[model samples]
Target chain A: MVPVDYYIILSAVLFTIGALGVLIRRNPLIIFMSIELMLNAANLAFVAFSRMYDSFNGQIFVFFVIAVAAAEVAVGLALIVEIFKTKKNINIDEMNSLKG
Target chain B: MTQTDFYTILPLTVLAVWACLLLLADLFIPKDRKGITAFLSALGLAVTLGLTITQVGRENLGFNNMVVVDGFSTFINIILLASSLFGVALAYGYIKRMGLERGEYYTLMLFSVTGMMLMAQAADLIIVFLALELLSIPLYVLAAFARPNLQSEEAGVKYFLLGAFSTGFVVYGTALIYGATGTTSLGGIFFAASNGTPGLLLTIGAALLLVGFGFKVAAVPFHMWTPDVYQGSPTAVTAFMSSGAKIAGFAALLRVFASAFPSISVDITAVIWVLAALTMIVGNITAISQTNIKRMLAYSSIAHAGYILMAFVPYGNKEVMPVSVAAGLFYLVSYAVTNFGAWAVVISLEKAEGKGLEISDFAGLAKKYPALAIAMTVFMLSFIGFPPTLGLVGKFYLFRAVIAGGYTGLALIGVVTSLVSAYYYLRVVINMYMREGDPTIEREQWLDFTTVTTAVATVALSFVPQWLFFMASTAALRLF
Candidate 1:
């Protein structure tokens, strides 16, 4: 049988990579995918911990995280598309109209 | 699931159901008569507020103890409901004038308020996570409500990205807590912590939770999106978002930390102390250089977030927690009122196409319209914590609480930041009353009403803060 420690280690690695992607990526779509990757990483950790603890609460929480991520995607993608409509490009650096 | 459970969430259920019904009713309302939708939204808030009033002086646990309806929840809910009413009033004329009138504005606002009320009552980590999204998703839409306007759209996307990023931290933190404590409920986690849960795991989880909520409340290092979002969104939406989101964020922080993690208070308090100090310093110093009024107010909101963070410095100290929490609540009241009043004035002078928003726009405002200028001056004074305003009394109570907790050095930092803040706040007052330029002032009735009423409240409430503080004292948090 596989140990829970391995699951936690894998999820932690995925979470770190996802965080780095969000910081380094310039495209809003890619940044958003990184966010989703981060959420899924946490979801993996939650499932592993739920099994380790022999409880359903962590699994239930993973479902909530999934649902919220979906909602965020709808809003975030609409925002990105709207930005694209005006600028013809959605580079993060170009969103400087209201900058200080 | 039971009578007690339903009773605990009666106010929330009523508001949520009313919001859904209002969304349906708005379909038949004529396009030009969107004002009816706004009126209906305020009516729902009033109904919920009435129910919330009756819930005071009584306490109950709901949903198998996932949420508690108690004095603290009642106190915060009243503030959220009242702010929503004010939100509807301010948005009524502003949206129509901006050509952004839509029925969904009010419904989304109502949905956001429901989430805020839930934040105040949350007794479990799951509820906290759910409530954060419920409140934020609508705001992301509302921030971008000005569709074709690139600035507003940018604000929407920026807010969404940062908000989603913060959610990742929160979820992972919750997973860690669950792993260490084997439960997602705040009370269960506390119980586990006391019974030999792994200390290192629990501390890391708590710190991660702090980082998530810090972003939500606009604390330093997580506050990069605040100014752009505030300066870009519609003025009326900025007015509502500044007050509602900060209040809800702090509510969730107080609820989760005070109830669930007092065991780790010593380790966390030092970090909060540094955060509060840095937020005050950075927010105040940055505000001094802003050329636009909206950006100025945005930084001011961030600085006040620091003052409120002072209340959490001694959250684990049983002797000082209630007093400090009450002080924090009092400061939120003062800040919300002044915020709405200031934003109302900003809304009044704000021209379509984003003209009349700079500090120079306020030049000769007093000469042209003494009444509006004076009202604006009053809000500026309240922001500066000057005499004869609620801001002064709020600061007094806050500093007193901080000093009582033996964090006098932190209290001194707050005082120094307040002094530094006076420069920018007074500049607006001086421009409004003394400088020479003609400013266009819109005279919509609702705009005038909210500005004048909140300004009056800011001054009048200062005279009798004891009664309000007395009420806040009774509205203390309870535990399982």
Candidate 2:
């Protein structure tokens, strides 16, 4: 049987990588993918903890998270497509029309 | 699952159901007559507002206590519904004038507001997460609703990316909390914490949750996206976003921290102090150099978030928690009113293609329209927490609460930042009154009405603030 600590450590590492990808990636699509990675990492932790505790609460939470993530993806892709139409390029950093 | 469950969340259910029906109803509405949609949305808000008002003094736990209908949620719901009503009023003329009128805009607004109502009622972390997204997704769509505008489009994408990233933190935090306690319900977590659920996981989970909410409320260190997003969105949306979104974000903060983590307040209070202080100092100082009015207001909203955050520093002190929480709610009322009033003036001055947004654009306003200039001045004063405005009374209550909690240093930072904030806020006033330039302005009935009404309320309520204070105290969170 796999131990829970190993799963946690793995999830944490994946979360960190996802966070780094979001901060470093210039492409909007890549950033979205990174965000998905983070969500999946959380899902893994939730499932592992749910199993260890023998509770269905954590698994139910994972379902909601998955649904919310799907909704986010739909809206996010639409936004990216809209931006691409106007600017003709999809570099996130190039969005400097409104600056501090 | 029971009828009690439906009764407890009657207001939220009503709004959500109305939004869905309105979404279908909007499909049939003619494109040229989007005003009907706005009116229908406002009617929905009015009905929700009435239902929320009826829920006052009636408390119950529903969905097996996954949701709460209590004094705190009731009060915040009243505020949210009223603000969305104001949001509808402001958006009515502004959208038509901006040539961005569409039934979907109002439908989306109603949907966003439903999410906010849900946020105030959320008792479980799962509901909180879902509510946050519900409120945010519509806004992500609304922010870019100024269709095909490059700046608005960019704003939408930027807001979505940052918003989603922050959401990841929230989900991860919830997972950690669930791992630490084996439950997702806030009440269950409270029981677990009190019974001594010992681990680093819970504390880290709380910290991660703060990071997520901090982004929502636009606290500094996580506030990088605020100015750009606020600047690029439509003025009416910016108006709604600043007040409505902030109220809902703070509601989530109070709900989670006060309920689930009082056992861990010792660790959380210090973190809140630093966040409050940094949010105040950074938000105020950066706002001073802003040339664009929209960007300036964005930073100003950030600074106000700091002031509201100060009331939470001593949340663990039994002697201080009630007063501080009440003060926080009072301050939210003041900020929302002033925010709407200020944005009303901004929308009035804003021209197509985002022209007339600079501070210099305010010059000659006194020359052309004295009443508008006066209303604008009142808003600026309120933002600076000056006398004869509700902002002043709100700050006084906040300072008293923090001092009573024994956090005088945070109070001092709040005072000094308010003083520093005067520099930029006063600049707009000076331009409106003293400088000389003729900036063409749009005259809309709803625009002028909202501006004048909120400005009057901002000043009048200061003199009679005890009523607001009483309401806020009555709305204070009940102890477990």
Best by DockQ: 2
What candidate 2 gets wrong by more than 4 Å, as runs, is: none
Q: What is the DockQ for all candidates, taken in turn?
A: 0.86, 0.91
The interface RMSD values of the models, given in order, are 0.7, 0.6
Model 2 per-residue lDDT tens digits across residues B53-103: 998898888988889898899999999988888899899999999899988
Candidate 1 clashing pairs, residues 3+ apart or interchain: none
- Candidate 2 lDDT over A1-100, as tens digits, reads 9999999999999999999999999999999999999999999999999999999998999999999999999999999999999999999878899986
Tell me the alpha-carbon RMSD of every candidate: 1.0, 0.9
lDDT of 2 at B421: 100
Q: Supply the global lDDT for candidate 1.
A: 0.92
Given candidate 1, what's the lDDT at residue B27?
A: 100
List the candidate 1 regions with Cα displacement exceeding 4 Å.
B477-480
Model 1 docking grade: high
- Model 1's C-alpha root-mean-square deviation from the true structure amounts to 1.0
